[model samples]
Target: MHIRQSIIDTSSLEGQRISQLRAAVEKRERGTILASKYHTAPLKIAKAFPMGDALGVIVMDVSPGLLSGDRYELQWKIGHEAHLFLTNQSFTKVHPAPDSMGGSAIRQSFELGRNAIVESMPQPVMLYRDAVLESETVVRLEAGAVWMGAEVLCPGRTLRGERFAYRSYKNRLNVYDGEELIYAQRQVIVPEQQLLSAPGCLAELTHTGVFYAFSDRIKACHAECVRSTLEAIPNRSGHPIQWGVSLTYKHGLAVMAAGTAAWLIQEALAAVWRMLREEMLGLSPISF
Candidate 1:
């Protein structure tokens, strides 16, 4: 049996940021807040709130988690000058359905307003054997807005000899400003069919992750500054990670693709985020 649910909420304040939440359960839609749920919603586990942020929580034990032919979507919109951070208390593990005669799929999307900021980083995603997962995140930002995000993935678990264990996992992210595409990335992984074990692929690396920051208001030498920071660090091969920092019209973007253990990626992201917060944006660190 397949099950799903959907939840949506919208909030606006005269001087505060607008809040919106959308979640699904049992393949149905329910009007629920990020902290509350209706019938069939995922079980609420632990939620945390830090200073200068909006929402933080974890919903787990999702009934029927995700089965073949299942689809899930979540969307949020932040008003001007508002800030929000969302995180999953734990890593999301994808397991093969009992009767997975076919394959499973998932999709996630986000939209933001001008001058709005969001930071969402949890643990890495684990893909089990014979599972197929497809996730897409789309962000629409206004001119002069900012966005920072990170993602981690394991090709199954190396300790378990689960090499290329999954059928496939593809994730795509796109950022736009008023129909103008600013940044776009597409990643597709197939253990059984791809060059995951090749020197260029995961290159015998167990886990990999990427972190990026994009902002148009950054200074003229913003891209160069970011590149210098990456050059200062090292990569999985004892060299600097494959770093790419560039400047576009009204925007500066930096992407780091590192081959290392999951924990290392997390710590590196924390450091990079801190540097950007203090030096680039002059904003205090807002933990989720």
Candidate 2:
């Protein structure tokens, strides 16, 4: 069953609807998909696409756009030996909330079996003026399982001259092995009360990308390569994009890129993913 839908009042935008999507893959081999199911509304999780041993899935938002008080849920289950990549169809634009109190929230879950691999590589989140969002992600991993995901957060609508105009954005990510929490992350961005461009903050960078990989197969060379590859991506601009990669406290690698433009950040992220896929996962780079 789909997760319990969050109670939200969307009366301001009459006829507005909430979005729920749940999809899972038991296994996939050759070109055959197995034991899969999906239920969707404004969001969709399509069938897996096979490439060598890896399977790719496209995620999309069918809504006109994210409206105020819209709640969304997406879950994916990967069984043993299953290799899945989840990519976004386009940027997710967070529109201004009508009922500021409820706002909009999204929750995503990933459940993986032993030796399984699942990747969540979505496009950037574009925050419009007065957009307020809360997002949560929970990952359940068995021994030897691997999970990777990347996210880009945009402060506001650049073309419209909305700079750090969002009301707030909060995110919490949790990873677990068995019943123990292995890693946790929390980010709260409130532009109204905080100076996002202040020293040690966003530092005049309007966009940022963060990529994470968690696995029991972490290697020293892989981490170093990931870091260097990100740093080496050339920026035609005189002021290069600020980026770095480091080994997380857990058995994973964390990469971050900050820039004034979303395109620059996205480019760096894709390059890093390409390198990691080839060197660490033994798969060819995926261009999408």
Question: Which pairs of residues clash in candidate 2, taking residues 3 or more apart in a chain or in different chains?
Answer: none
Q: lDDT tens string, model 1, 104-165?
A: 54445555556766666767877877777777777777766677778877667668877668
Q: Which stretches of candidate 2 lie over 4 Å from their true place?
A: 1-17, 28-34, 99-101
Tell me the TM-score of each prediction against the true structure.
0.75, 0.90
The count of backbone overlaps in candidate 2 is: 0
In candidate 2, what are the lDDT values of residues 76-105, reduced to their tens digit?
777777788888788888888865355777
| Whole-model Cα lDDT of every candidate shown, in order | 0.58, 0.78
